[model samples]
Target: MAKSDKKPGTRRDILNRLKSNGCSDATTLAEVLGVTPMAIRQHLYDLQSEGLVEARAEPRPVGRPAKLWYLTEAADRYFPDAHAELAVSLIDTIRSSLGENALQALVLERSRHQTVLYRNAMEDAPDLRRKLEALAEIRSREGYMAGVEETAEGLVFVENHCPICAAAKACTGLCAMELQVFADALGPGYDVSRTDHILAGARRCAYHVTERETVDG
Candidate 1:
């Protein structure tokens, strides 16, 4: 892959600035990033091509209308919060009013729904890798920022961003429950183990998925 000319964190910084300012021109973005207008334009060009940023023409009192850059709805994922606070609060309320058993039951119910969706997606998949890839795509749409990678020994499925991080942190058992659901969704032929956990201070949640061979006794 070709490397980006923008400095490290520059893309994120640009996205953050546009997120806070709403709409701004190259001149304003340049000032915010302490770079020249030319540099800002280049970055904006790249971002626009990626469908993360958009340029709109707005009328000015003085001269011609200036084109201002704004972050697209798709770019919202790059920002913080991700609705984790609300999810965590709801989980807390359920635990407080309904008790731990109630909370477990609710999580189970949700997990069951997820299992059905995952099973449906993976049913026609031919191999373990395709099943994992399909799972990642489904999770990504649900705001997990998930992806899959191939390895010599087994496949590694990773979720870089957790939309319900706060809720998961509030209830650690959700992690184990997730592992179980994943195993169940893919059937009993594979051993799926969590290699990294975001709730445990890791930057992501990863599972090492390895297929098991059947032997006749």
Candidate 2:
């Protein structure tokens, strides 16, 4: 058989490569997956019917028109939600196997693990204000409109917007939890206050961190 006529890789391989490339059209995908154009088209159609892919018309010259295929943004829902699902399942299993107290301890342990990860990612600097500024810049690069300010209260890292979670308000709670994690990482006796009014008009809402005064002083 001719080299070009060789059988192609599995459907999963085709789907993975397409996703990795930010969703390419059928012809491009066929080249990547080592498949015939017709086979790619058939798989694309199947994926579309399953709500895993979307197709858009591409403007072309006088020849036959072409449609670009892309993995739907909702495609992440198929695999991405599994981590959260597993977390909940593990908690439930622990509760069933042990008890509520054991489950609570497990939750606390997991919280500490998450806190450590955030802390390691944003370690403390000699200058707290500078540290906050650096962290804000990092957040901005990650798609949040973020900044730091030395307010009357203390060093504040304000997040003006969150691009990713804006569309899903229910997930905003995770953002709030992240702020608390930042505060905890900053250390004991440090106050981290979030202001709802800072980004009142924003689509998802915004947050500000303020250092609290210590009573010992």
Candidate 3:
């Protein structure tokens, strides 16, 4: 056989694959990474020993259960956090000295600013698909690892990673305002609903965006 030019996957690549695609068995991960299942299993075991990954038995009909590997909370250290500690500290400071109401005002202002920025970025996007693509690019640049998925019903905007997860946990207002920002950024005639939330124990955040019929007044 001829030599292959593709680079072999690293532990970080395995972590990233799990982060983006959720849980998977060693066999599946091996196939995706162009390596043998035994090699992948060894890597997974090493990661498990380091407390970065864990495996759960998934039931299989008429056969032994398969071990599904997934990233543990500790694995989050490998991903980008976008200055999580500083963001959380600022949130706490604002709420303590500026008051809860003032903190809320700041959140709203931040959402408004995001909405305007996103809108401006998507201004020339011609249609909903293009607009969603533009929005995903903007968010991915901001460390959300965002992408748009097309479905028969509509589009699913997926954020494979949340850089502000720490700040969002400290102040729930950030998540709420985020949903609002997405709605406003997409403009009218479209409804954006959060289908998954990382804070709620999901591996990633997903938004279902569908068009709503508008009747002329």
Candidate 4:
């Protein structure tokens, strides 16, 4: 089949396909997605920018020319079949770098860092409006859609969704860890909640977070 016959594949689709196939050319990907090879190139560029896909030159004896595209080891994380060993390796690295207790502490410390960084960056804002805007800017830069609002109680930092987590639900534990980090950074007094109504569903995210003044035990 020609590359132009397939539909345009999203980043997730591209990653999943690559994970399963190991390597493929743009034409092959386009053929699978029912889109033009050019469209596949565009998606590949997007994925490449995110440190997912990679391309390599292939010397062919016939035809005009073609380059072989492949998924990096990083891209393999999207496939469930590959994630178990990857997770083990990641945990092993963590265990090697930090002792068990220290690893746990590191997780907490990093979460605290995320919150503190967000709060400190927005410290100069005069009002809640500006604060929320600042927070949104920060999260967007980090690939999230963040919003803040003032309810009847106090200010709330709502992370609309997590893009990375949405790609692989098995990593939702990491999302919970991040929430814990945010809570720790925001302090023990603020309430943090994760909503089910995510915008992107299993693809992206649509989350609602409400911050409270006093958190109960």
TM-scores, all candidates, are: 0.65, 0.41, 0.92, 0.42
- Which candidate do you rate higher for TM-score, 1 or 4? 1
Q: Whole-model lDDT for model 2 versus the true structure?
A: 0.60
**Candidate 4 Cα misplacement greater than 4 A, ranges:** 1-89, 96-100, 147-173, 187-190, 197-217
lDDT of 3 by residue, 133-196 (tens): 9999999999998989988768999999999999999999998888889889888878999999
Could you arrange the candidates by TM-score from highest to lowest? 3, 1, 4, 2
lDDT of 1 by residue, 4-86 (tens): 34557777888867654457898887776777677778888999999999998999999999998887767856755457778
Model 2: ten consecutive residues of lowest lDDT: 197-206
**Top candidate (TM-score):** 3
User: Relative to the true structure, how large is the alpha-carbon lDDT of every model?
Assistant: 0.81, 0.60, 0.89, 0.60
In the range 140-194, model 4's lDDT, one tens digit per residue, is 6775556665666555555433445432343344455765655554445345665
Error of 4 at 108 (Å): 1.6
Point out where model 1 deviates above 4 Å. 1-10, 13-82
Off by over 4 Å in 2: 1-9, 60-65, 73-77, 83-112, 118-169, 176-217
Q: Could you tell me the lDDT of residue 88 within candidate 3?
A: 95
Q: Give the C-alpha lDDT of model 1.
A: 0.81
Where model 3 places Cα greater than 4 Å from the true spot, the runs are 2-9
Prediction RMSDs, each to the true structure:
12.5, 11.3, 2.2, 13.2
Q: For model 2, what is the error of residue 66's alpha carbon versus the real structure, in angstroms, after optimal superposition?
A: 3.8
